[model samples]
Target: MGRTVVVLGGGISGLAASYHLCRAPCPPKVVLVEGSERLGGWIRSVRGPDGAIFELGPRGIRPAGALGARTLLMGGDRSQTQHSFARPEPSAGASGHSVEDWRGCPRPLIPT
Candidate 1:
């Protein structure tokens, strides 16, 4: 039997770590634990009444990193939907608002 590694979170970082760990030369038993019922943590996408996609939290990923590229490919329509919005809510908010208001800034401050 292989060793087991229990991941504490289901966010991108934790999931990426677990993925790499499992893909190692000698794979281990990896189990990801997400406190919330949903995965992807702060990243969530919801469909609007008009059949458009709106991200409640962090949206898509940049296709730079290997994992990010993979995510973009796998996300498919959801990824495409990300670009459909003319302007995300967070960025459209009044300037100098709270940190929460800056979440979806036109382009995420971080590369992701």
Candidate 2:
């Protein structure tokens, strides 16, 4: 029988470790256990009504090291340009809305 490794949490760290372990010359059986229903942990993104994409957590990542750069390159979305966020706006701010006017109490204070 092969070896077995149980990984706790489904965050990037756990996922990367599991990926590397499975990709090794001699891989072991790995079982990942996540306490929460959702994976990716603190990395989150949301689309606003204005169509602007906002990230709630770690949005941009710098891949300098070999593995880090490889992971970034492999995972990168080629269709989307690197400066996609800098695209010109079709309209002014959120129509006639303001952050304060949001349905739910605004979590972070977005400066105008």
The lDDT leader among the candidates is: 2
Q: Write the per-residue lDDT of candidate 1 for residues 1-112, one digit (tens) a residue.
A: 6799999999877877787787789988999999998887787866665565556786444468886677665445332332322345544234555444445556422111
Which sections of candidate 2 miss by over 4 Å?
Answer: 46-54, 74-112
- For every model shown, what is its TM-score relative to the native structure? 0.51, 0.56
Instruction: Provide backbone clash counts, one per model.
Output: 0, 0
Query: Could you tell me which 10 consecutive residues in candidate 1 have the lowest summed lDDT?
Result: 77-86
Candidate 1: misplaced stretches above 4 Å?
49-51, 59-112
Clash pairs of candidate 2?
Answer: none
Model 1, residue 45: displacement in angstroms? 1.3
Per-model root-mean-square deviation over C-alphas: 7.6, 10.4
lDDT of 2 by residue, 43-70 (tens): 7767677666677776356568897777
